[model samples]
Structures are given as structure tokens and as C-alpha cells.
Target: MQHSTSRWTMLAGSAAVAAAMFAFPSSAALAANATLPANDHVLRVCADPNYLPYSNRAGQGFENKVAALVAKAMGRKLEYTWASYRGHGGYSNFLAENLDARKCDVVMNLPYGDHEESYTKPYYTSSYVFITRKDTHYHIRSMNSVSMHSIKIGFESDTTPETAIKLLDLINNAVAFHVASNPQASPRELLQAVQDGKVGVMITWEPAIGDFLKDYPDLQVARVPSEEYGPGLPTVGYTYGMSMGVRKGDTALKHALDKVIAREQPEITATLAQYDVKLLPNPRHVNFPNQ
Candidate 1:
């Protein structure tokens, strides 16, 4: 079953990458899909189209800036392929189509701390916050505060939400409506759940959570401090980074990408800020890594 799913995922990713490349003719061809050498004048990137605050066709998102930054640093141009990030098997599809198929050199805006995808380094760190009813006292300041009241937390599966909640031992608070399937569900779903006395919390990351609050004035998010959770669930931070997702032996490209990131960090952050994307801060550098 796993193998079959994996194969299907690969096909889906490949198709997506192909579609993206076809959509953007200006971009360079990838090694996996067509035949582009590492010495090509342009770098190919695979991104999620509908995902905002990250990458989109408008070219104003953080990931897009990162891509442009790397290109500028390397004195190369950027070509992009877009895909939809639905759920669980997403990276597999992305990897199969983009990396394995060589349609793109890097998958931008991946969660920095995620070990599953072989991340580059810690770039930006954001926090996982929840929106609860203004009237409710379910401040997500700590896990112990999560009482089994009527509070239901909306979490996107197979994401930091899953890991963050698990680390906090707040799995029981999870509301299983499947956001991936019901992409149209409003931010009000969480609010309605709380207002109707269904759930007390709706856990998600930025910038959606931030966007949700903007749209719904009544919905207030819980600003959970990182120290509120246990060690594993330490809310101290979540990272957003970019890395070159190459086939297992694609070390040469990876080395080149790392150098690009180092050189282009400043320009990337400036571009991102233009889109209202505030990257996480670090002691040495304010820019996030992976990209």
C-alpha cells in the first residue's frame, strides 16, 4: 500500500512539475524533466501556487523573493514550476516531479526544522499560534491549560501542526475536519466551532492564522509562549527555510545552493518584507535559512 501510494505520489508530482514548467515557458528546463546541466544560466524552482505569504503567481511572496535572491546572487535567472500542496504525500509528489524529474533545483518555503525532507539549515523561525474565542479562557499558553472543554482545534495534517500538537500532547484537542479536503472552509469554522461551544482552539501557523484574524474581527488567536510546552513541544520557535531538493547523490548542486543562500540572504529578506512577510530572527542573522 505504501509503495503504491508512493508511486502515485511520484506521478502526481511529476505531472504538477510538468504543468508548472509548461505554464512558465520562460523558466529553464530541469535535469529530471528535460536536460539542463548544473552550469545552466538559470535555476529551476518548484513552488506551491496557491500558497500565499510564501509563493504565488503574483511573485510577491517570500519564497518567490528567496528564489530571485538566489538567482541574483549566482548571477543566474530563475524559472519556476508551480504545484498545489494538498497534504501528507505532498513532498513525495514534489520530490518525484521536481527533484527526481529534475524539473526544479530547490523546493522553497519548506519548514526549516523538518528533518523528513533533508532541510538545508535554519533560516526563519515562526511560532505556532491558535485562535480561540475571545470569551473563552483557553489560552494556549500551556498544554496543561488544554482542558477537554468543547474546544476543538483545527489543524492541518502532516504539517508542523501535527508535530507541534503531538509535542504538546494536545492531539486529543485536534478537530478532524480535514482542511486539505475542505480547502474552502472559512476561518470562521474554527470560530463557529468555538462560538457554538464546539471547540476552544484552532491551531495553525502564520500567515493564514494572521490572515484569519484580519478577516474575522471577533476571532482572537491564542499567543502561546514557547516555554509553555514541554521540551519536545517547546514553542520557542518554528523555522522556515529553503533547500535544494536533489536526488540522493546530487551533492554538487547542493553545495552550490548553500553558497547561493549565504550570498543572497540580505536581498531575499528585503524582497520578502515587500510582501509583508516578516522572517524569523536569529542571533547572527535575521534571514531564514533553507531558501
Candidate 2:
């Protein structure tokens, strides 16, 4: 449960190793979609085939719906370059396979300000949350509420929640389960642990909790309050802004996407609401890049 390794490193290994190991799809295959009729405008999106609440091959995730909305607003056809980064050793080579190799023009969801690629202005913000059965009545809204010595909490190993638990000295009483240990360790299995009484509570990302709540009304989630980083400054713990990704130096495409995001903001919110995604409030008087 207590491992001294960063989650990002545990998942992606080293950049050099990832580049050397992943076989980039051929240029021909990447450009195949470009040959469509000139009149047919298409937005090629790179996405995972099995990741849920984000994307899947069947286009069921919220990101898929957002992509479709963007395409429609721009009067284009939606196409996907289904890439399985999880299969390549549970790490994502998104920038390489999706953008560098020209497999897709854009990635639907990526952490905003990611240096790996140019990101459009963030459309939404999210954070980690605590999930527990409604009957437990364990009102754990923050790390302060956790009884380090008595209450047992569960979280995906090598995630932000585990890090927070360790920082708060709760690792000994926490159950850290590695999702990569089993490729199928999705939200369903994680929540099932709490439902089966194997774990008292589970700390996971909010998006997954939102999706699961629809089917399991017996479960409830508590949003983690923003942590004070310094005097007069507080930031949401494990929270991040999410945005669409395009290749570096693709300024025109980025600007066009920015316009689309600004114009279709309402539609995007509605789409995310349909999936029960918990949205963070936008900061006031904020300025985004290229704005």
C-alpha cells in the first residue's frame, strides 16, 4: 500500500522507453482519413478503446459526446482513431500515437497545461472524491475527517488519493488496490468492493463516481475540499483542468478549436451533465492562452 513511486512514472515509465517501445502507426494509415471527399469535413479524434467515463470503442463516454458536439458545431463529420495505450504496458503514449504519428488531429481529453502537447483552453475541472455506501453515514469530506487509526479506506494504488492518504499518515489503515494489476479493475469493481463490505470507503476520481451513481443510488460521494497550499491560497486537492489536445505549433487548429469551445460551451456542459460529471466552478477574471 505504501510505495515510494510517483503515479505518473508508475503508469508511463520513462519517455525514452515509451518512444522506443511503441510502434507508431504507419503514415499511410494515419493519413487514410484525409482522403475523404473534400466536401466532407471530418474531425479525427484519438481515444482509448476501453477507458470508461472518458472514452471507449463504442463511443459511450462523455468525451465521445463532446467530440461529436464539436464536430457538429464546426459542420464536420466525427471520426475516431481508436488507440489502446493501456495494452502497451498500461501506459499511454497519447502524444506519439495520436499526434506525432498523425493518427488523429486532436485528443478529446487531456490535462490542461500538459507540456507533452499544445492544449486548448480547459473546458472543465474535476477532482478526486470519496465514495461510500449511504448506510455507512461516514461523512468523509476531507482528509481531516478520516480516522487514521480506526477507519479503513480504499483507493486505487498509485493515484492521487493514495498519495494524499500517505501524506496524511493513513496508509496503514488504507487498502491500495492497483488498477493495472487487472486490466478490468474499472469503477465497477472498485465500487463493488464497498458494496460487498470488503472496504469501508473508496476514494476515486469524481467522474467515475458520477457515472456509477446512476446505477447505484445506494452509494454516495463527498467532494474533497480545496487544500490550503500557502497563506491566502487554496487549491483543490488532486483537481485538474481538462482540455482538448492538438499537436504543438498547430496554432490555426488550436484557435479554431478554441472558438468552437467558446461557442458550444452550453452544449458541452449539457453533454457532461448527461453523464453526471461533477464540474468545478470556473475561476473569475481568468485569462486563457491565446485569448
Candidate 3:
């Protein structure tokens, strides 16, 4: 739940909360609204100014690079509408306040399957990964071990790792970090906890922590297996196709954005590689390749 679903929670809280924030017409209606037309001379993007590996005010994240490509291909200049992904507003409805409100026209890292908006074609897909300090030799690639019960692990709530840990009765040895938590960089907080010896392992969406690995050179990563996607109601999967989110029923804009995605895919792939964000090798047969 890093960049994509981490942006969620607000999407998953409850049906009433979800439906209250959107204008998903039974058909196309946004085309009739004049307040936020799509064909403007600028590509207005919504992003977190402090969230690294995704976006920031400095235009240094992979999403920033991808958005630049989209704007360039569309023959428009790029403009950002900054939004904080976390802190202060506890579980803020970022989409309602931004994209749906026309404050911005696109949101990258919107995981596939989000029903609140009409999203563009996926630019890249990333998986959940296991992170451990090299000095500890955690070497854990799967969540099925009996050793799981003995390790102190930090896992995101409402995600595959949480589900697997719960199913195996390993919750006692685990600390849970909510993607919807308040007032701090939750992903970095967890990793810092591990580096400080508060926890020995962490399971999180790779991009959320990938770019920050440079600060903790001793940290190592392994993809959490696909089988850990968990069970029961409201389960998010192991791998997600990352796309761009625009207003619901905004087909004109959606189509325009799709063309950019299809055309600049090679550049997008290269941008992701710059951040150590690998595209999934296989959807169902995901593996933890050596870096």
C-alpha cells in the first residue's frame, strides 16, 4: 500500500465514505462541466510534495519524470498541484479534495481497480517486498516459515503481509503500521525502526521504501511471494498495475492521457528503473530477483 493503495484507505474505509466523494456518472457527464477542461495548455498533476520515490516539490521522483513525459507528448507544459499524502488531516480524502475537485487533472501511482476515477493505462507494475538489514541475514522471501513466528516484523495493515501474518498466528511477534496513519512518513518510520533495532523485518510496497534505501545501505530487499496476497474480504493483491487517475467519466482527458502512456512507455520504464522500482517479471509468478 505504498504509492498506490497507500493513497487508498480513503478509498477503502467504507462504502458511504467512498461514494460520498465521487461523481461517477451512470454515463459521461464531466465532459459537460466547464470548470476543469482537459485540453488546457498545461498538464495539471496532483502529487505529494514530500513523498519520495513517487513525487515531491523538487521534481525528483519517478512519477515526476513520467508526468513530464506525458505533458511533453501531449504538447502541454507540466504543472503540479501539491497535496500532502499524509499527516495532519488523518485519512484525508485526497482524491475528493484534489482530482475530483478539479484542482488537478491527473494522479500517478493510482493502482488499477480504483473505481472512484477513470484511470489511464498502467505505466508500470510493482510488488510488495521484504526488507531486512544485511547484517541480520533475515533472507526471508516467503511468509510461510515457522521462523515467521519468531521474527519481529513490521507490516502494513489491510495488505497481504498483515493477512498472512494473522493467518499463521504470528501477530504476537509483529508490529502493524497503518498506511492510513497520521503525521509522519509511515514507510520511512517503519524502516527506521528496523535500522534502529526496534524491528528486524519489514514488508511493504517496494516503491514506498525503495528510493530511501540509499540512506540505509545495509538494508536488502526481496519480493514477498504472490501467494501472500491474503484471504477474506477487502484484500489488496501482491502486485498492482500502476496507472494515472483522472475524474470519473472524463473520457476525453482519459483518452488523451492513455495515448501518452502508450507512447512514452519506454521512457516510463527507464524512469522506474532509476528508482530501483522493477516492473513485475510475471503477474502471477512474481519472484524476488537479486539487485
Candidate 4:
């Protein structure tokens, strides 16, 4: 589902063209310095300001913890390049416009499993689910479950949920509700709908759901599995593996960051837990951005 932040209307291939058009020395420059610094003092990180459960300026989100882990791994202080990701094109736009501009060296909390963007390597993994009242028997553990019951499920359009429902054939049966009745809806609306019980449940990643559950005591949540995947869809639940986002051709930095993530996984997981973030069945990749 798409969030209702800025309406991200892209001109198709905008991301690719943006990359091709914005090609400059920054990508190569960072790639050259990808090696761990001898002193381990500072690692500039790009983060979203308003995205919660994942990142925020408050340094309370999972991404903040992740940044700390990376910093610790590099023996550097964590510095941030604040950006905003509020739409379909927001991520690509932020990466190209900001990170590519050399404002930051690395981007955390990106989708590692999706083909939308190339990634370094899997650092953490997670799945999506429906957050609802414990008493609600919707039992949305799979696509078939979604079809068997009459549910008014709400999600952000243009997001993973939208993509999942479209492929699952559950759209017809789902009281398919998007945050916006017309063009799109914001992330807040979906959160509100679930919190207010306007909808039986809202589809979301576990990280986001964990935060919601922490704040709201009465809600119950369930993760969908790959085995639940129906025909023509992913066999497993929507597994979101997260990795650092580096510009294309920045292989040196990507490789270095990959090693950092691999070596720091334990610390990263601990930091996330300290922030009250939950990784179901263990973090398969890293940093579930949905939260």
C-alpha cells in the first residue's frame, strides 16, 4: 500500500533516468573510500526524518539503533543526513537527490528483497502481517484466509500491501480499502484505521506492527507465511530483507558495508531490541522499513 505523504507521481523510469542523468563523481568518490577507516570515528548515514519504527530524527527508531551499530562496528560516531520518504518515488528520489549528492555515504532501512532497487547484501529479514484485535477471528495467515472471510482490510496504496493484494487475487474478496478513496492514502490513515478499529486489520510489516502493538495493548497481530502464498505469488510471506543502499557502481563501499553488517548483526539486533523493536522468527534480513 502507498502512504499518504506526498503524492509520488512518477513519470515512469524516472528512477532509472534519474540515476543515469545524475551520474557524477560522488558515486565513484565514495566507492573509493569504502574501506574501514583506520580510526573508526565517523560514518555519515542518510535517514528519513518522519518515518517511524524505521527512522526519525529522534534517534528512537530501529534505524537509529542500526546506525549506532554500524558506527560501533566502524568505531565511528553516527552522523545523519536527514531526508524524507513519503511516496512511491520517495525512496528513489531521496537516494538520488540526497545520498547521491554526497550528503551521506550510506542509506539504511531499504528493502533488500524487492527488485525496486539494488542492494548490498542481506543484513536483516522480516515479514508482513495483519495487525488486529486479538478477539477478531479474521485469522489472515494467508491469501486464502483473506478470501474466506469478509474483511475490510486497509492499506497504503502503491506499497507492498497493494502489490501483494493485486497478485493474490484477494482484491475481489477483500473489502479492499486504501487510505485514500481516490488517488492514494497516507501511512497515518492506515495506522489510524487499525488503531480505531475502523477496519478489521491493516497489512503492515512486523517492525511497524511491533511499535503499534507496544503502544496499543488490545491489538493482536499475525504474520502471513510463504506457504500461505497462493498461486502466482511468492510462496513465503512477503519476506523483506533489508540492506544498505549505495549508488550503483559503488561496489567497494557496498562490499565493505556488507562485511560491516555481517559482523555487526548481533549488535544490530540487540540495539533494535533495546528500542522495543521485534523481529519475528529472527530478522531474516534487517531493518523492516514498514514500522
Candidate 5:
């Protein structure tokens, strides 16, 4: 999430290939208990097999459950085409290999707006949070907080949070974490640093924080607020909308997904809750371009 590469990068190979002639406006339009290659009865999902709290080969991630919910709502079978979203080069092959190659109809958990693919309206919103040990003497609600100046901070370098820290003259107090060192283990290592006293506080995106929270009972989390921004920081940008991606012009699937997302929002929220996700308000509205 902290990479310099735009997370909303374009599809490497843009193909307008449509599936069967049929297109459904919503899940109801599809027949129940249908199978693939039979009038598009299956929801082919493209996902990373090991990114937990999100997805994995074992299908234990919330995104997996969300995918099933989508398929069930559409009355179609769920079939997965596993692919790593990241690699030695970092999130480079995701769209080229999967979405562009038509490995799946939709790719889940995209940050909404401005992408090579036509993303469905956001399904949920989350934020970057400030995590600290429970025994810490104070809270860090933003970069300007009093505690932030004295504490050693840990964050993936080159992100806005790092920028904010630098502008605030706290660079000397910062500790950098490399998420790409090990996609599966990086977040854990960051959290572990906070847990083990390597850093007094850590700021991280919400999605990566939940899965490791159970192991760090002493950690306390606070959602960084939008108000945390100043001259250099336009907004704390703690909040962001997350959506699903489909072919660039696949409005058929796009609208259908938007409906399922709205209809199944309750279930989706519950899924995230099961992982102890740090829920924040905002992102119910998407910042899409002119309609």
C-alpha cells in the first residue's frame, strides 16, 4: 500500500472481450445454482493466495467470504484463479496476468477512482491508523500530536505518512519498515516492532493491521483523522474507499457489482468486523469522474 507505484495503475493489456452474450444488471438476473460456460453462471475471482485478512489459498480472508457473498447473491458458482498481486518487482503483474487476460470477471479490493479498469462503486472504507502500545503514556492522533515528536515512529517509507513526519521535523525519530521484504511477513514484522519496543508507535493502513492484532494484545489503535493535514498534507487521508475492478468498459459487471455491494453491505461490514478491522466513517460516497 505504501509503494510509489500508483495502486490504481492501468491494465497492462486492455481487452474488450465479453463473455457469453448475456449480461445481468444485478445478481437476481442470474439463475440460481448455475455453472460456468453455461451462460456465465460462474463468478471467476482473481486474488492473491497468501495475503491474509484479505485472501489466501485457504479462502480464510474476508475478501474470500465477500467473493462468495457476491457469487451467492448473483446466484452463480465461485471459481478462483489464484495469482499473486505482488512479486519481486511489486504489484507489477496483477492486471496484466489476471484482469487483462480475463482470468476473472472482477478483482476485489481496489482503491476507488482513477484506474485502468472501471472500478465498481466502493464497497467499504478504511484508514491508515496510529498504533501504539497500551502502556504508552499518550496517544498520537496525528503528526502534530505532542507524543509524535518524542516517540520513535515506524512506517513504510515513501508514503504520505513519512512525508508528513519529515515535514514536521520528526525524521530523526522515524524508523522505516519495508513491506516488500516479505508480503506475507512484512506487516507482521512491522506490528512486531511496535510490540517489542523497537518503536514507540506505528502508523499503518487498516487492512494490514487487523490480522496481527490478536497477537499484540498490548497494542492500542486510533484512526488517524482527516483533520490531521496541514500545509504539506492536504488531508490526513486516513480514509479511503475500496472497490472491485473489472474490465475497463465492463459496465455490465460493474453495475451488477455495485448492486451486490450495496445490497450485501451489511454482510461485508460483518466480515471485516470478524477480523477486528478498525472501522472509520467516510467513503460511502465515491469520487468518480464525470458520469
Candidate 6:
């Protein structure tokens, strides 16, 4: 799933194009005795002001927590550059407005392999999950599960999960939700459909799953396995790495952020766990420290 708050939209390529178009500073320029903002002592973070479980204006999201931790560790205060992401062309210019414009120094959460900017070592991995209430008795572990074709699945349109469902011939039995249909629509809407018995299951990104499951503990989550992928389902990976994003030329800042990530690995895990974030295998060989 594409990170940076919402997973429903595909903006990775657009962001990369914006980065190139903006003519952001090169690595050489960034490495030439580059330093943090003079005398500010602030960690400027770029984030979506309304996207939950990732960031919000109130600083309640897991990314907000991690950013705070990083700032505290570096003896700097936390500052925010609130950029809104409304999916597609609505507010998809975050790369140009925030990073390239120097609105903030770092984006706290971005897809690890995203080419839009320089990335620190991956901090965590997550994926889309199948969500169903416990009372439904619908055990969906993989695409091969017998219940796959029988249940009514709800998912956001134009997502990896939706593509997989189509490949499995489940689209006819699926309810497709669209972000553009209503600017306020969210994973909550899909989860509510399941709760109201409108759909038997909902497949969505893990962060939203973790957030909504807090209020509906009876809901079961099944992580989509990588081995279940087949022909015509090229976009449906079960897991993806996530990392912090910095401007392309900011190698010095990138290295410093990486060091902070390694030193604060335990705190970062704890912060994500506090928000019920479902963490996948640590690609950096870092284990979740003792709580």
C-alpha cells in the first residue's frame, strides 16, 4: 500500500515527478556543511492534518508520536507543516508544497522504496488485511480460502486489494468504496458496512485496520500473505516497508535521521504499538524492545 497517511490513493509516481520538476537541491549541495535551521532547535515535520492513525493537526497519530520522540532525542522542539491529502488531484501536491517548498524538513512516514525523495532505513513493514467481525465466522486467510468467493467483500476502489479481488473474480460480489465519492469517506465507512452487516468482510490497509479495531475488538484481522499472489495480481503485495522522507539532496540530514531511528528503535516500536499499529518483520534486524 502507498504510505503517507492514506493508502486509498496512488500518488507515488506523481510525487516523484513533482520532485524532479521542482529542481530540488542535489545531494552534493546538501552535503556541503548543511546543518539544521539556524538556532531554531525545531524538527519540522510535514504531515497531513486530517489523516488519522498517521497524522492529524492534534498530533494524535503514531507518526506524530515518533516525530515527537525524534525531536526530543535531538534536543529540538516539534513543529508541523500541515498538508492536506484529499486523494488524486484534490490535494496531491504535497511534494511540491511541503518538501520542495521547504515547508518542512522531513515527512515522518512514507513508503520505504518511494522514489519521490531520499529515505532513511525502513522503520517498519505493514500490509493490507482482511477484516471481519468475530461473529461472522468467515475465516479468510489467503486467496485460496474456500470462503473467498462466497462472501461479500468491501474495499476501496483503485487499491491493490481491489485489484487482487478482481483477479480472484470477487469483484462481482464486492462493494467498491471511492474516496472521491465523498471527501470525508474513510476506512471507517467500509468498517461500518461490515458492522452493519452490509458486507461480510472489508480488506484495507493495516494502519486503518488497527485504528478502527480499537473500537471493535471483536473484528478479526487476517494479514494477506505474499505467497497467495498469482498471475494478474502484480500490484498486490502483502507487505511493504515504511520510512521517513527527506529532500533528495539532504544526505546529511538523512544520515542523522537514520541514526536517530536506530537509537530510538525501541521507542518507535512502543509508540506505534500504542496506536495498535500492526508491525511486520523488521527489515533492519531491529527487534521491538522490552515494553
Better of 1 and 5 by lDDT: 5
Off by over 4 Å in 6: 1-5, 10-40, 87-92, 179-183, 228-236, 282-291
Q: Which whole-number lDDT from 0 to 100 does residue 96 have in model 3?
A: 57
List of clashing residue pairs for candidate 3: 1-6
lDDT of 1 by residue, 1-291 (tens): 111121111121111212212112223444234655565588788876655555678875667777777777777888888765543344444555555566666776443333234445544444445666676665555434645334566654544444556766667767654444332343345446655656666655444434334555666755333343454532333323334454446566667777766666676556655653444564332123334
Cα-based TM-score, every candidate: 0.65, 0.79, 0.81, 0.72, 0.81, 0.81
Compared with the true structure, all predictions reach lDDT values of 0.51, 0.67, 0.68, 0.58, 0.68, 0.68
Alpha carbon deviation, residue 35, candidate 6 (Å): 14
| Steric collisions counted per model | 18, 0, 1, 26, 1, 0
Q: Write the per-residue lDDT of candidate 3 for residues 1-291, one digit (tens) a residue.
A: 222244434232222113233322322333444455455798889888876767889998888988898898889989998977664433235665667667788888665555566777777877777788888755686887555667798887655566667767888999988754543454677678778887788888787777778788878888766553345544334666667888788888889888878888888888888887867845764221222
Estimate, for each residue in 81-102, the C-alpha lDDT of model 2 and write its tens digit: 8865445434345456666677
lDDT of 4 by residue, 217-272 (tens): 77776765545345564333355565677766667667878888778878777876
The parts of candidate 3 lying over 4 Å away from their true place are 1-5, 8-38, 87-92, 178-180, 228-236, 285-291
TM-score of 5: 0.81
Judge candidate 5 against the unseen true structure and give its global Cα lDDT, from 0 to 1: 0.68
Winner on lDDT between 4 and 6 is 6
lDDT of 5 by residue, 43-89 (tens): 88898888776788999988899999999999999999887765543
CA lDDT, candidate 1, residue 177:
40
lDDT of 5 at 27: 40
